[model samples]
Target: MTSTLDDALKRLEMAVGLLEASVSRRLEAENRRGDLETELQLMQDDRARLAVELDSALTRLHRFEAATDDVSRRVRQAIGAVQSVLVQAGQLEPEEG
Candidate 1:
């Protein structure tokens, strides 16, 4: 009877140790999951910010391209007018090449 009681007590102690170790492992996993979630949120925020900045830069580039095209058209018109005037004054000959 005494030997049986000692065996029971030892089994109980082993069970308690196993339970504690399991709980410790679960807590560590939870902490790691929380850290991963925080990092994911920060990455998402950075991606959103970068997307907005890229869109703004593209908008500015488009505006610059439009302005350059307009300037080029106006310059072409001015050059044509000058060439016509020079031809009328007999100061420039029409190119044969």
Candidate 2:
């Protein structure tokens, strides 16, 4: 009877130890998962912010391009007018091309 009681007590102690170890592992895994989730959220937020900045930069670039085109057109028109005036004044020859 004494030997049987001792064996049962040993088995119970081992079972409890195993249960505690399992709980500890589960808690550690949960903590690691939480940390990973937080990191993912931060990455997503950064991606969103960068996307907005990129869009803003692209919009600015397009506006600058449009302004540059308008300026070029105006310059060409001014040059044509000057050439016409010079030709009328007999100061410049018109090109045949």
Candidate 3:
């Protein structure tokens, strides 16, 4: 009977140890999850800031490209008109330098 009681006590002690280990692991996991949530919030804020910057830069780039196109068109027209004038004056022969 004493041997049986000792065995039962030993089993109870092991069960208590297992329970304690399980609770510790659960607490650690909860702490890790909270830290991850904070990190995720920070990342979301950074993404929003970057998105605004990208949109502004794209708008500026588009404006610059439009201005460049306008200037190119004007330059081509001016060159065409100058060529016509030179031909009328016979000073710009296509056969000579």
* Top candidate (lDDT): 2
Q: Quote model 3's TM-score.
A: 0.69
Q: Show where candidate 1 strays beyond 4 Å.
A: 95-97
Cα lDDT of model 1 overall?
0.97
Q: Taking the tens digit of each residue's C-alpha lDDT, what string does model 2 give over 1-97?
A: 9999999999999999999999999999999999999999999999999999999999999999999999999999999999999999999999688
C-alpha RMSD of candidate 2: 1.7
The number of the candidate with the highest TM-score is 2
In model 2, the runs with Cα more than 4 Å from the true position are: none
Superior by TM-score: candidate 2 or candidate 3: 2
Model 3 lDDT per residue over 1-97, tens place: 9999999999999999999999999999999999999999999999999999999999999999999999999999998788878888997765344
TM-score of structure candidate 1: 0.81
Task: Give the alpha carbon lDDT tens digit for every residue of 8-72 in model 1.
Answer: 99999999999999999999999999999999999999999999999999999999999999999
Q: In candidate 2, how many clashes are counted? A: 0
Determine the C-alpha RMSD for candidate 3 after optimal superposition of all C-alphas.
4.0
